[model samples]
Target: MTNWTRKALLLSVSAAAVAGTLTAAGAPVAHGRPAEPIAPPLAWGPCEPIPGTPVPAGQQCATLRVPLDYRVPGGPGVDLAVTRLRTDRPEARRGTLLVLAGGPGGSGVRRVAQKGGALRAATDGAYDLVGLDPRGVGGSTRANCALPEADRHVVTLRSWPAADGSITENTERSRRTAASCARNGGPVLGSFSSRNQARDIDRLRAALGERKLSVWGHSYGSYVAAVYAQEHPNRVDRLVLDSTGDPDPTRVGYGWMANVGPAVALRFPDFAAWAADPAREAEGLRLARRAEDVEPLFLALARELDREPRESEVPGVPLTGNLLRQALHSSLDSDAGFAPLARLIRSAQDPRGRPALPPGLAGAIPDEDASVMMAVICNDVRWPGPDSGYAGRVAADRARYPLTAGLPANIAPCAFWKYDREPKPVRITDEGPSNVLMVQSLRDPATPLAGALRMRAALGDRARMVTVGQGGHGMYLGNGNACGDRTVSTFLVTGKRPARDSHCPN
Candidate 1:
């Protein structure tokens, strides 16, 4: 029933290219969590197709019924949106490996189709690739805030402060937003927490009929995978966490935002170098004659925008300081994005030039995505409530991390969020298999090396991490060097992770 063809078309663009083969083991280690016999095979069938996308040649889609609430297994259930790209090399297939997408809001069913080929090539066709939309995301059951179109805009959804450091506006907006979510957001919204996402993953494993599941998770997905492994350690065969987060329970979104300061500071040099390069001159995007001058120039530009908002393609929506900051925040996530940001800075600083707006400034984030991104972080952990508490933190954070200013540590709508965490946060421990392989970038603007180190420390000897002396979020064929990619691919395919933690030279 699925629009297999439509799905395929959308996925082909994002999927990685496949290459040479690598042979590896299919069997799990004997003494560890004994592999239980595989469950009864699922009667795989055609998926209800999404119009305008193609299903992989042999892949199919099915709905996995999971409890709406994990604590009550017999309660009403929701259908987890799922898809599979089976291993072409069945003889080499070990088991099904599920891909957990980043963003409690990210769609994984689409991600598999995008990255399937490269992933298969990475593991040498050793496992079937699969993914799903967590509850309250696309193609799964969903929830919406009924938020105003203006508030749904990305710039506003993230809680950018007023042109000045005055968060008076942000504070009022945060309170109203919290009230809106509590009002219009329903039962499914409450179910968007990470705990239930982990439970849904386990149900998906059972539905797939696998004795054990390997995982490749990115960004927020890394947090979900970490929690999953903690809750169901015996169910995991191998795990790969890329672009992880701080597992600190005390300061959920607060810590995540606080981290952005240093994360951006770490990433600023990358932009500076790119902006100063003579090569960027051809694009009329060079910002500074020297690399080191770029940061100060940007600080000046932000101050300029703060004082006099510049009009762009989006009428009435002048480029504000927070918008510029958010732009920098998004650009640092990937290297490919650096040039555009450099160009923007160049245009903004040009005396006679009026630059165009960056893509989607006026566009609306889908209602469901808006709800989950805010909900998951707020619902998973608590946030500080007092405005004075945030003011003091912001002032200190701004002084220490000028690149991100006080943004990372600023208050969000979560401060006014109604629902408390449903359960204690899952604490990642070193009690699992020795099959996990972590790949991280040294200067990731989103998930910094510092946090990844926490995850590595938590996993202890149960894992081996390959720290790439490079910058950018998402590693292992995403932003990593060949040696780093080779290391992770080797572990995924062969089950031979690093004998110890190692570093990949820049």
Candidate 2:
């Protein structure tokens, strides 16, 4: 997940009074409900933009009240922070387009602020771009596990095995984390599941007074969008699932996590090629003279660090093998991250040089951010119990995929998470309208092309996937692939899709 600064918005008065009745399946109950299904009107005003992201001139913000628990719609509520940028050319406007952010903890309000202008221009002002901070995200009602500072660090939170591939410490951390969340997070944290996020989007839809919403969901958001499309088939207009993963209901987030080791193996060659390029020598960033040599060099450095960690710019935090491994995993997400990663590797190799850790690796994340990231994954489905042979799996995975060092198959907090009350994950099927489109990169470190094929197959004829001959996590307005970007933009603006599944050569 990208590091994002939190920006809190003021809660509106609409939250004080319940406005709609929702069923367990997220649909509005009609006959038996005392109140109509209509959502309360939003009170739009200026947005309190995130530090680095400026809200566009016409962008407006509002507060939306959704149920704290869908099963008890009339009980306590949580406020979602929403943002909208209406089209400048209203005459040519197609409809409202919702932009869903990734991470399960990603801030959609910030996403709209960062990408709204480019998206507006890309579609030729065809859509009123809109986004929201799902519960426990930035600007929305939050839940905290009050976890220890060490446990909140990205490397630790990811449950990376020790240098020796022993998961003893990882297991302890996972159990403690699960206990802390259950003790402190209460119902708000438990409600941070994908299905609840989908329900929140539908609430946002009703609040906007739009009969149907066109969606652009990225990463984890793609799964939430798929769940929404499955639950409310008739309410979707056009859907775009970007950088999606396998929608296997039984596994859900666990499946995504398990695929990461192999995905990194698939994507590492791209970084290796870039690091070995002749042009990088002029920039003083070349890691190896040949592409194949880069892997051994990295593995050797990591093993050395495991034996003797190097001091880093962050005073208390030394650069260890697992930290280096985690950094590599993150750096593989984009080409822009290559140079910094190469520089860190060079610094680590120097006996007297101190490496400057990437911001994400340098410090512990916010409690709220860590809380949502853990909650969503753990709440969505059941993971193997504590005695389910995680150490053996880690050993096998580490031998099979050294780049990730068995981190993907390692024990997570979900293993200790209480699953007695959690609902089964929603299955993504081909039952929805054929308006769905998936844009995927051939080599995505987080969500590989192979997993994307699973999503495409599950959607069957209901979806058409555009496989870009690129390597990264996100596509369409990202990665600067003109062909892929144009295809998504054209589909959004004119509703024209490719004749069938197609590929865009790099």
Candidate 3:
């Protein structure tokens, strides 16, 4: 699986800016003040519509006030941005299910709005759908490092190297970017870590009057769910982890990025098959007569771009090797993205044609999103202190997984990040409730089968996994086989986990 897929598979949330101590010392304390009890009837207010959004009917928005530091509930507080779709079938209602979005920075409110229907349908309307914008995201308390727009651009922020594959530019950029965030991003920025997100989820759970939560966590959200399950096992009723991560505390963000190479290599064949099909000729994008030939052609084309970029649809933004690779990386996550990639490839090779671009490359991730992503990863763990170490790993990865080149193993802003890890990483264990049900794709490029196996083993007997014999991430009702969907839905509605790990054939 590709690293992004794995990270995506783990949950929608990425393991970026996760720092702080999950120590006993850090636990919420009352000091001299009594704790505020969670009450019924949530304080209702008008939700600030998401920028470029249309509010759905019956969806209510509100602010959830939580302790800034769980230990000092009375000292200072923060507001959690939240949205809810109350149970459509109140007569059949079970309780509330929270949608934990991935990306320590991703907005849960948006995810719930987008995916709430699917989740409700999947559960047969057993629960209400709730999503929250984690701290530092939209509608919640926000923060920014206010760095130059150039440095803040997505491509630069991700540490994508220069066209020639040199790390000097990436290294320097990482250092400068880290320095800027440290200088400008303040205390609020420090609070945007994973541990706090878990705390916030718990706070929301308490606020909602739900004794237990049935959770649907995507990408980075899976990690958050796993940690929540570990911390408050009794508070969980049913759990679904989509597109999971390695969850290896030792590696954290760096290890997550390093896996990208193999992830791309694994998912590339699916794209190759689609591009080489006879049906694709009408699109003017077919690259090979046979599927095996696609990787070599892509590699050659990337190398050629490395030597010389071609004019792209985006003015001044030449289609360089890294850009092509990143596009391929993004596109391969779903079958829907195949056409744009093929069109781009065809445009690049076509003397008179233009390759189309994916939206991610069309523009940078918004500044707020970028800042949150950068902050959480750097804050979550301390990266290797030296550039040489990254260089060595990059060279080694390039040899082992040439499809992604050395991009996965390359230096990121975290390498030169300002803060050291303040908390020990949460080790996901099987001690959580057996209510967890994991759904995964067999041929997923992002969160590969091998990594999911580790998650399965870790959760041992405490969970059951349904393996969809298909490609892409988020197997449950998402680019997955019917059998897989049925398996997850059955477990979610009936609380009947599979007796053992099972497979769903395409």
Candidate 4:
């Protein structure tokens, strides 16, 4: 609980497994799933160990070489760290299932290593599970802005306003941070966009010798999956998009960030209900006598912290209002986050208590890690500049949703970033294969149901959507949503989708 500890937390966030585009003029050449050629045996070997989460014994790792830019396939290439957990029941094996991690910054290798066992069990050994770290992320081709340590911290990167709630500092930080990334991040960094990532996925498919891929792409990964499906339709057998952000082709990443204004409002009540419950008393986390009162209690606390931040276990970095908001944003990703958030609230309220920063926010994120987050979002598409009335938007956002206090709506480095080398963000189309299945949580904060619906709409008749009456970012294999999980797994194993768009009762 020192400043160093908090800094440690930030570095981990940057390193945590968490990344580009193609265009309309060069629209995807019409194609379907590639030929059903047997993928050559992976040079299977033991997986590298990850701290805290051990790799399942069955998992194997390998690397695929992909060009940093698809346009020059003959040019220099980067290694895509790939992982696989083969089916024990090879006789029952269906095909390969690609698992895509969220966070334009998420590490696919780490994600597969983490979820391999449960995925194998859930799919009944139906397919060999495979994952690939995208460029600018873990185990793949890496890049960094070498951003000043001061700017690498998530708190600073998050665009939180000054104590008086002024955006002047935020604007300068945004500009400075953008300038730093552009200066230190070279060609590799410039190539960090969704369009490139999708192309990389296809190249991996070729390397694996899989004709058709069954993919499960979560959160930001869902958008990646959608783009893949659109670009190469026939090559996909079954596509599952879980907990997706809105892919308004025009707005891209910034749109998703702005939508957070309404997203948290939608998901916060669930946290409130949990925090107000009688059962929480056992945990010393009960925050309010009634669920309805939880809103005022939380908003007031944020304002109080804004006025006077409390000292945290980490030195120098006090428990400020935006930090609480940051923790809340992450907590809404699932119900499991409820207790810790409640505990944080309890700590902040205690005069003698010191709040511990959330694991993801306690310290500064890695330079490369922070770079990945910033690069992909900043490069994927263009955003509002100084003339775009961002201050007015932030003011409106803060006025309408005091709980968010404009962090969701504030200007990001992308607003000042240069994306000249970045190709157009993928246009998710309804013309793709009808093999896609989307699962969404009704009350997800990070990727709310509303945004998922936009994705469903974009996919149109090409996809079937299942909305779950739950409260979390990921519904399938997450959030304990049995109905939702079963729905997705059934479709994957049996190839039968719901008759129509449907709801999975909580």
Candidate 5:
């Protein structure tokens, strides 16, 4: 449920039918076709008995052994952690509805716990709710790059330049991070592509004894679900893609980072309205007297920080202009994040006190978490290099959208990745079954509405869309938009979709 969900998705689309079972080779599987040969069945047991994350009661867990490299089937296997909340009414149970969580880093086993109750109520026991930790995630076959602690810190990992927006430190760190991953991540890290995750989804379905899967995909999960729908169109039932990003094959993950420029601009007004509201006065969170004054006040503070970085409670790491700007971006992922971000800002502005860092930026990420986050994106598609005029683009993006402070346009380790692209990035086409439904928030800070529209276009008539007039990264159960939630849950339960694009007002 963190702000970002782009984690690991393995496999790439191919032409050959992945019949009998999809080996790691990622043999292309046709849509709707029921392949006879299936993977071994999963051994279901108590999930709460496990240590890490606790699953809800009645939620059972299982482990499926998928090939580390599908291309090399019959080789060593990776344990994919899977969970399911069975229908309360067996007579009403139609099939399994798989929920793919956001984050290349989001843990599906955990997401199932968070949204399980709401989903059961929405579907009225019509389908079982299922989810999994994709490869490289928790409870699954885990992999770590063993990156340096300094490089793993959010402030450093994000490639935010110095206060003045210089790229010197950023460039060195990007290259170093990439080098360490290439040296330490090994094959498991290399195996974290979204295409592969699509294949992994099929394997999960086979293990669950489901001929086809109903999907509720969120954030990066939307892209994974789209890939599965494209590769095995026949194998999908009702597909709900929530908070999707652009399916631009060439840019993939890198483009998503860049789109933050427009995404933040589109959603900042909502935050301004919240920040300047009279209701916030009691909390000492008001940034300005009027909503219009919020933007100027924020920009002024950032510039002042740029000139003079203030020390944070966290040792060594100071509160810089970009850190403040990045905090704003993170807050917009959900309205719930608004108060903490506001408090952080207010603390930073205190002249006599040490500013506190946001939890996300206070410390370095876990090595395995950071590794997969980078591997999945880098493995999915290529990013721009210095030769591509990224500096010029960064300058333009920063000028046009100062709120993002050019971090969106800055280079990432992917720009200097040593590994080659997988079988290639998967392109979403209209050739598959028309089973996909999309729900998007108009003012989402991440995966903006514009990208979701492109995804809508890419799916062609194969998909229908519902636009929720809200401001958040995820719209379904997370954002509490009843119209949007009902629209999606109905499609899952009844397999019916809106005939055309529909808008649900705030």
Candidate 6:
């Protein structure tokens, strides 16, 4: 669920953030189809540091040219910015490991730069780490819907419903956003779909001159990775899917959004416990003496802000209930986000104090970034039509899960998107080699355990799952659980997974 909202908020906090058959003429043939030209070798060079992301020392960069549409192999292409951090000990290097960053719009090049060093150490220099900026992301070819500045804000983009659970505003926003993208975003935007992304990965693998590739994918990337594995099962080796969601082809993106409501309910207790701790008193961050009181306090504050939005640090953007709820969703991703959230909550509770908006909520996201995020989800699967009784669903969801306030069920830009008639999403199955390993947090605010279990079930014998007794997204090398990290790291390095499904204590 590294959708626009989560991606934007996470970025604001710290400024964070395949196989082929062969043919003559260096082209690959697939399933009796005519041969398609293989991507040319990438010319690796010194990587330029991406703004707000540190490039690891000695990381090399390159670009791969992939067709905008695979069906038109000789058509205009898009440039994929690629990065690699070669292992220091090439003597022990096994192969190349691709880092699949989360988000349909996540920058894999940035992810490689950020995690290369730690990953190298974790695998004991067993593989060269490499990643690429998926199309419409980072240094790759980008697209824009010419969205209004107001439409680009994370809160607005997320389609948060009105305080009373009315989705009228959301419906209008979704319609216009869809219209804007259709009117402004050309074939480039239309080309951004998960299947295309999976095809892009195969092109990346070929460009790297590897017959097989291992992968480490988290969040939405896990879904992409799974699709790639399903599409090209024989080309994958030592796969690790971290914090994945259900891969219901009919409802790929919609299912993910729907899961957020239940997921947040499960993960909020962790934050409530932390916020109610006696130790937080010294820091002036405690919200309640009892853990049970924290949820009510937060809900009351949100409702109050709903009726009367409070002024925020951002001059023009006031703190509305949806914005506060958005902040809570972002904060619940990790324990580290608790303090800033607590501070914001405390400030909001004060009569005269002005709340400081999270960076993601302070302003609009870049046009291209927003475009890609919207395009991929909308393009992947057809969403419910405007007449799908979204209002009734939102009302029911709001009553069932007050924490999310019906946002998860509200209509989104996808509901009105003009899809390019792309084929349906591939259904993930247990057809692949049994070389996949999965590590999931018991309480991921985004991906959630229920969805992860569905993914695990879909993969069946093709994978083994390690459920981490933790509460956060990204299980490996994230959320600070040694047991989960070790399980995934060991699998990546040694190709030895637990005999079956296992649990890792926090």
> What digit string (tens of lDDT, one per residue) describes model 2 on residues 255-325?
88889888889999999999999999999989999999999999999999999999999999999988898
Clashing pairs in 6: none
Q: Provide the overall lDDT of each model, using Cα atoms, as 2-decimal numbers.
A: 0.71, 0.81, 0.71, 0.76, 0.78, 0.81
Return the TM-score for each candidate structure. Answer: 0.89, 0.94, 0.91, 0.93, 0.92, 0.94
Clash count for each candidate, listed in order shown? 23, 0, 41, 29, 27, 0
Question: Candidate 4 at residue 212, lDDT?
Answer: 80
**Candidate 5 on 185-229: residue-level lDDT in tens?**
777777788888988898888888888889999888898999888
Runs in model 3 deviating more than 4 A are: 1-41, 45-48, 51-54
How many clashing pairs in candidate 5?
27
Which model, 2 or 5, shows the larger lDDT?
Answer: 2
lDDT winner, 2 or 3: 2
The TM-score between candidate 5 and the true structure equals: 0.92
Worst 10 residues of 1 by lDDT: 13-22
Kindly list the per-residue Cα lDDT of model 3 for residues 370-473, writing each as its tens digit: 66777766666666775458777777878788777787778877766665335466677877557888888776766776777777888988988888877886
Model 6, 1-506: lDDT tens digits are: 01122245533211011000100011232432323337778899988757677788899988899887676788788888888999999999999999988876788887887788889999999999999888788888877889889988888878788887888888888888888888888888888877788788888888889888999987888889998888788788889999888898988878888888999999999999999999999999989999999999999999999999999888999999889998998888789999999999999988898888887789998888877777777877777889999999998999999998987788887777775454488799988689999998888888888988999999999999999888888777867499889989999989999999999986
Which regions of candidate 4 deviate over 4 angstroms? 1-42
On residues 117-219, what C-alpha lDDT tens digit does candidate 4 reach at each position? 8888889999999998887776777888777777767678778766556799888878877777778787788878777787778777877887789999988
